[model samples]
Structure formats: C-alpha cells, structure tokens
Target: MRKKLASLMAVAAASTLALTACGSDSGAAAGPENGDKKELTVGVFAGWDEGLAVSHLWERILAKKGYDVTLTSADVAPVFSGISTGDFDMAMDVWLPETHATQAEKYGDKIVELGTWTENAKLTVAVNKDADIESLDELAGKADMFGNRIVGIDPGAGLTKAMNDRVIPQYGLEKMDFVTSSTPAMLTELKKATGAGDDILVTLWRPHWAYDAFDIKDLKDPKGTLGDAEHISTYGSLTFKEDFPTLAGWMKDFKIDDEHLFSLENAMFNGADTQEYAPIVDQWISENQEWVDSLTAAKK
Candidate 1:
C-alpha cells in the first residue's frame, strides 16, 4: 500500500510538469491578448524615400500605442527576405504588378500583404525638364546630350533591373552608360546636372519628393517596358496577423495619397539638416493630427 501511494504521487508530479511545459510552449506562440508581445520589427528598404517616410511614421504611431517598434533598414532583396522568414514583422514599400514583382514571386507564399497605401508608383528614366529629348525612343540618339550615361539607383533595385533587361534593349540604348550607385549618388548627380543647367538622365520614380525638389520630367515609355502604375503595398511576415492583430487591422485600413505622402517625404528628406527622423516624424504627425489620428481610430 505504501509503495502504491508513492508511485501515484510521482505520476501526478510528472503529469503536472508535463502540463506546465506544454503551457509555456503554447503561451510563447500566443497572441498579444496575453499582454506579453509588444515588440515589433518593421523592415525598410534603404534609400527608398517612400518606405523610409512611412516606416518612420508608423514607428512613431505604434510606439505611442505601447508597442516597442524597431525599424530595420536593408536593401530591397534583404527586406523582402526578412519579411518572408519572419525576421521582420512588416515592410512598408513593396511595389507590385511591376517593381518588386521578382521579390513577390520569390517570397509570396511565405508573407502576407496587408494592403496598398498608394497606387501611383512607377519606374522612370527621368531627365532634366529642359532636356531636348522627350521620350525613351529619342534617348538613344541624344544619349550624348546627357553625357551618354544614365544615373541609376541601387543595383539591386527593380528599377535598375528593368532598365538593364527591358528598357535598354527595347529602346536600343546599349551604348549609353548606366551607372548603378546609391539613390543619394543618383540624386547628387541630378542636383549637380540641374544646377549647372546641363541635360542629364537618371532612374527615378513617382510619389518621390524629388519631383518637388528638382526640375525634372520622366521620359515617355511608348513600349511600356517599365510597366504601368504600381501599388505601394505593406507586407508582413506569415504570422504577422496573429502576432500583431492591432497593427494588422490598422495597416489594412491605412491609405495615404500622393499629396500627403509627398509632404511627409519632403519633411523627412528634402531640406532637412539632419538624418535624425524621430523628431521630424513627430512634428509631421502633430501637424497632421486629424489624418494621423484617423489611422488609429479603429484601435479603440
């Protein structure tokens, strides 16, 4: 009888331990309703102004709502990969139906798209407004006029890929030198060329603050090689909705037009003396409180 009682007690103890271990494992995977999951990671594609602008905006907004949000910047490819692998909770500037389509195809199954914030994005080969040529077809003949070079953004950018694979071949611009450098480098070239009143060509995009900051125009793409207007979407990790239900709902409802997005971009990038974005984003949010508040209206 004594041996049987000791055996029963040991079995009960083992069962309790097993249940506790299982509970701990389940709790780790549980949602924020448990009140322990507050950290969020947002991925930003480096040198993409729209991404930078919106990411910073959300970081401030989420932080105010008790989330410890962290912004991680990387090149386009890495950002998408990080989102797919759940390393980052979300990415703000994924252009679809054209730009970033490659990344989408590669990781589409592993990630979730919350929604598109803007639909006016497109890749372009922009030239000085006063440049003699008006269309991509005329660019080859007049390539020398703009120094026989095309200033391009990051080499891994979808814009660079489109320019190299489709635009150049379609338009017979093989002779023109396409420079693959950072966006800042391309912008520097743009500023210097425009400042000197020289004709220049560079890869550019819509919804960018550069149009407001510089005197430039996108050359016509008669062949439609650069693709049509794309939607700038917010993408997340596969478990994003479960991990951050509040953010998922807010992001799905989030929409910003060109006018407001450009304003935010200009404030963050154009004419700003410092690289610090926290204060700038805060100021922008304060000025646009009504609209900004609307972003989180569903939260409460």
Candidate 2:
C-alpha cells in the first residue's frame, strides 16, 4: 500500500471519534453470544490471489456463522488505509516486517496485527530455466538476453519499489527497461516467453502458482537487495478485538502452510476458467472440513 500520510491522518481523526462513540456504550454492546453487529468488511488487494482466496474463504466461513461479510477490492495502499480508518474490519494478506513496512509504520497506531499465517514469503526475480543468467548481478551485462526489459507488476507494489530503488542500482541495471504492469500482464509475458523457449525476467513472489505453472527459477541475489523472507499476516482495525473478540482471537490463531495455500490457489487460478473461485474455494473447504473447523475452534 502507498503511504498517504495526510489522508491516513484524516481518516485516523474520524476513526478516533467513531471509536470513542462506540466505547461510550460498552454496557449495551453486543457480544458473540447475542450476535449483534454480525457484519464485517474485508479489504482485499486486486491481483493478489492469496488474499482473494483467504478473503473468500473467510467470507464463506463467516456466512456460515451468520455474519455478513463484504469483500472490497482495491490497491494495496487503500486496503491498509481502509483497515486503519475502520472502513474495513480486517485484511488477510499483509506481508510483514518488509514488503509493507512503510504502511505498517505509518498506520501502526490505527491498526492491530492479528498474526502471521503464511511463512517463508519472498519476493523474487524469476527467469525461465533456460535463461543464461543465474543471478541478479549478471543481468546488467546480458540485458539483451532477456530483451533488455524486466517485467514487473503494479508500480505501487513494494516489490516494484525494491526493484527500482535497490535491485536496479545495486546491480548496475539502470539502463535496462523496467516495465510496470499488472500481475496478469507479467504472467502473460512470462508464458509467451517461456512457451517459445525465449528468455524473460519478471518480478514475482513466493506462494504464487506461477512456479508450478511455469518452468522458472528465482535468480540468486548475492547482494540481498530484494530483502529477506517475509510472512503473510492478518491485520485488524484498532477496535476489532473489542468489537469481535471471539473472531479476533480465532484470527490470531489462524495458520496455513505453503502446501495448502498452493493447493487452494491452484484450484482458483489454474482452473479451466479463472472467474469461478468462490465455488472452487467452497469445494476446497468441503474437502478440508477438518482444517476449516480448526480455524474457528474455541480459543484456549
């Protein structure tokens, strides 16, 4: 998410007032026992399949428990901003201690980090296995091998920022083109290049289906410019715990490993048609009922 400090402060002010109003009526506030305010708005970033999958899974799970869940899509910036301002109840895919460090620091006071569910998250510069280069330090000298361009996703993404701010300069690749586009566009280019056995380099992330869908390898980063491994986390608004204590506790304990996550993502993205993910996720949940049950189990 882009750090819009001014807008964040404005929203923080409004949220403070609303939170104060809620706090004043603590005695009358309803709890999980009474099922009052059984609604939630979850912010999700577009083109983030993991977020989409987890959000939809929660949407379905909460619905089963009689909560009205709304999924709102936007850029990463607004998702964090919305959650900070209480416009959204929570978000499921915050890459922590690194990818979203700026936003987290800017809005840390306004939000609560529920917990990290997916571990070993990473940003990468991936190339077709057939590519000549094996590392980022080698890219500058052989830029033409991959068409003198580095395909990237959303310009606002932390991955893009790292590429432009650190990777390019550190590796002396300032002259090569860095194309900013959507994940789908980058994937399309990747597919085209790999299908024809042509060389291509693209910015990518771990826990993504591309690794399974394509024959690609992450280029080694000798200087560690791309940053260390991260974790995918959940964040809630300041008053979330007070408002939905049970759900908040459940979220804090929620966890998912790469295997299950990849299976879910593959079901959604690698299907014959990518549009019907909710049903696919529903099927996944049905098949994995034990795991889903564990997510909402009573907290000790």
Candidate 3:
C-alpha cells in the first residue's frame, strides 16, 4: 500500500484521515440500530487534501444508507492493490488512462473499475520561485540548477515512475538524479528550500496543499511528459460492492464540482474548520436530490 505521491498530507494526518473511513466500520461493530451491514475501510491517495473530506463525506453518506465505512490511506498504487486483495474496501480518486492504467491493464479481472469520480487532476514539475526554472528541458545540462537531485515522492507512486521514466527522458534529463522520499519528507525539503529562497525543483500534482501553500509554479512540460490533465476517478475490490451495496453504489454515482471539492480541500490543507464544508456539501446533495437519487442506485 505504498506509493510515493506529491502533496499527500503528513503521515500523521494521512493516517488519521485513512482511519476516518473506518469510523463507520467501528460503529457497525457496535451494532447498527436498523440491522444494517458491517463497516468497511476505503484506502485513499491523490485527490490531495480532498481525500479526507471525500472519505468522511462517503462515510456519512454510507451511514445514512445504513452502512458503516472506514477510510484508509496509501500511496496511489497500494490503494488499488489493497482493493484488489480485499485488504481495503474501495477508492474513489484513481486518475484514469494514466495514473492507474497499468493497474487496470494488469488487474482488471481481480478488481472492479468504476467510472470517473472527479476530473481535472494535473501532474507536473514544480520549482521554487528562486530556482527561476520553467521547463523540464532547462534541466538537461544544468545539474546545479536543481542540485542534480530530482526530489520525488514515494518510490512506488505511478507519477513518480512516469516522471522518472517517461517525462525526464523525453526531456533529456538522463544525467540528473532522482531521489525517493515520502510525501512529508519531500515537502520538508520544499519547505526548507522555499523558506530559504534556495533552488529546488520537484514533482507537483494538482488538488494539493503545496499549490495552495507554496508560491510554486508548475514547470512547463513541452513534451507532454506530465500527461494531459486527467480525470481522477474510482475503483475497488469486488467485495466493496457486495458487502456495502447501497453505499458502494452511491459513491460510484457521486460527483462534486471542482469548486465544491477544492473549497473543502483548501479547508483541510490549512486545517481550517470543516463543519461548514460538510453541511454545504450535504445540502448541495440534498437540494440536488436528483443527483443524490442517481447515486442512490444499488448497482451499475
């Protein structure tokens, strides 16, 4: 369940957020008042700061439908792997035709692939403003520009691999070095570099706290190495559907606009009060009853 991803919350916050989905599962263990099903855990990655909110929101929606849920956190790849093994229940932010395409190509039969849950996720290169670099090509012969070290998130993360394999090579950065660190570690480096106004270049992904917190800019990828801005979506083990039919169906049908998701994301990133976010999202769903009714389906 490890994939290094850029912009993931700290290990502690990430861990707590992961367990939130399981909160419903704990309630189920206590016994549901209406004889509803047991609780389950959903592993998460990407979808940045929105992950915890997404997990909690799903948990509430699942509970409303009479099922308990728990959310787990993992690097993007592990989230998919765990679901396939039934170690985790489901995930709703798998970016498709790019991020998890390999998982789909290899494990399509073992797991279930649902439709897009959220769209407009973007992966790219980012550097501190002090670095003054603007494109991957600029790093070709300028090793010192980035300390010759390309800081990356977790080793198993799909985008990191893609950046190392496809993106850098496409931009002719073979001489540069790639270093793997956890999301928090990389951020620590970014914080240090940016705070000191030093040169630092690293991977950047959208829907992240770094973009909101740091004055970093995504370096242009002239070769399309970052891939197109993608549709971030969902996937899970077959058991997720079977064990929590109603909730699973609702999540698959769930879709929130970027403004709504981003607002919650910003709240979580800065550790702001989220009491309002929940109600607003809930009301949006409640008022848009037809959309909720759509998610209120039991199967694909």
Q: Report the lDDT of model 3 for residue 75.
A: 61
Per TM-score, what order, best first?
2, 1, 3
Error of 3 at 145 (Å): 5.0
For TM-score, candidate 2 versus 3, the one ahead is 2
- Residue pair clashes in candidate 2: 1-76, 1-77
lDDT of candidate 1 over 202-237, digit per residue (tens): 988787888877888889999999778878889999
Instruction: Return model 2's CA RMSD, one decimal.
Output: 7.3
**What TM-score does candidate 1 reach?**
0.75
Tens-place lDDT per residue, model 2, 78-195, is 8889999999999888887766788889999999998778887888899999888899988888999988999988776767888889999999998999998667678889888988
Give the TM-score of each candidate. Answer: 0.75, 0.76, 0.63
**lDDT tens digits, residues 238-259, model 3?**
8656666655555667787755
lDDT against true structure, model 1:
0.76
Q: Name model 3 segments beyond 4 Å from true.
A: 1-41, 45-53, 60-66, 72-89, 106-111, 129-131, 141-149, 155-157, 174-179, 236-249, 256-300
Clashes of each: 0, 2, 8
Best by TM-score: 2
